[model samples]
Target: MRPAAPEDEPALDAFFGHVDAEDLRFRFLSAVRKVDHDQLKAMVTIDHDRTEHFLAFDPASGQIIATAMLAADQSFRRAEVAIAVHRDFKRMGISWTLLDHVAEFARWKGILTLESIESRDNHDAIDLERERGWIASACPGDPTSTILRMTL
Candidate 1:
């Protein structure tokens, strides 16, 4: 796994397609946006001027299977981490790998806390955050979404 690149845009879109539609909606907060190739790239593509994006690939097959983003807010000393695993690799630990990578990056980057904006319906994601000791609370700016935070 490594930082995402411009050339991996297509793979990123394909992998997003591999995840269940409901999972995508849960992560993104809307089922209406199809997340076209351009949008997917913008979502996970690296931009040092802005956010950091990570991609995981199969060692043998060289296939990108999971992706995550850690976007830091300069004024807050906090970062938002988002991750997705291809449905084909759902039970294979890819999501955990992505989370671990993001967590490490957050620590290395001097981020005091990491937050995950999850929908109330996304039990799996909420459970994962709970398992990792993230505190769940109502989103400060948006009441509809639940925010999970963890100290680095």
Candidate 2:
């Protein structure tokens, strides 16, 4: 895994394109048909101190297969974490490792809490978060979604 640079936009776009549709919905909490260039640029043009993006590449193909992002608030006491792994790369422990990495990164930045907002239908991700000791609860007034929180 490595910090995402502006030049990695194309690879990031391709990585998003390679992700499953359902996974995309789970990641964005929307029915995203295609990831636009502007969105890709936003992902790559992060400010490392408050917002960090990381990409995991496939050793054999050298293609990006997973991504993790942590965005902290102005207070820097808490951060929101998000991750997406390519369809072909699922079950390879990519998400697990990325989440772990982001949690450690958040701690190093003095973030006191890490949170993930996920769709209720995303059972696998919820399970994984639970396995990592994240507390899960329903998102307020949103029956279709859930929120997971981990205290650092």
Candidate 3:
């Protein structure tokens, strides 16, 4: 895994192509048909102090198979993380690994809290977050979603 660089936009965009529709919705928290160039640009071009986007590659094919993003608040005391993996790479423990990696990175950077906003319908992700020790609560004013939070 490595931090996403500006030149990695192409690869990141292509990586999202393999993310199934439902996963895209879970990642973006909306029904996006395709991840736009602007979003890809934002992912690659971020301030290191406040945000991080990581790319995971397939060792054999050298293709990007997953991405994990962490964005912090103004004070850097808390951050929200989101992850997405290519459909072909599911069940390989990539998400679990990335979540742990990102949490460690966040802790190293002095972030005290980590959280993720997830759709209630995304059972696998919600379960994984809970299994990883994140506490889930109903998202205020949005009953369709759940918020997973952990104090690091």
Best candidate (score: TM-score): 3
Q: How does model 1 fare in lDDT?
A: 0.81
Candidates' RMSD to native = 1.9, 0.7, 0.5
Instruction: List residue ranges in candidate 2 displaced over 4 A.
Output: none
lDDT of 2 at 149: 98
**Clashing residue pairs, backbone N/CA/C < 3 A, model 2:** none
Cα lDDT for residue 15, candidate 2: 91
Candidate 3 colliding pairs: none
Which should have the higher lDDT, number 2 or number 3? 3
User: Between the candidate structures 1 and 2, which one is better when assessed by TM-score?
Assistant: 2
Ranking by TM-score: 3, 2, 1
| Tens-place lDDT digits, model 3, residues 39-66 | 9999999999999999999999999999
Please give the distance, in angstroms, between residue 87's alpha carbon in candidate 3 and its true position after superposition: 0.3
lDDT of each: 0.81, 0.94, 0.96
Off by over 4 Å in 3: none
- Judged by TM-score relative to the true structure, which candidate is superior, 1 or 3? 3
* Candidate 2 local distance difference test against the native: 0.94
Best-matching candidate per lDDT: 3
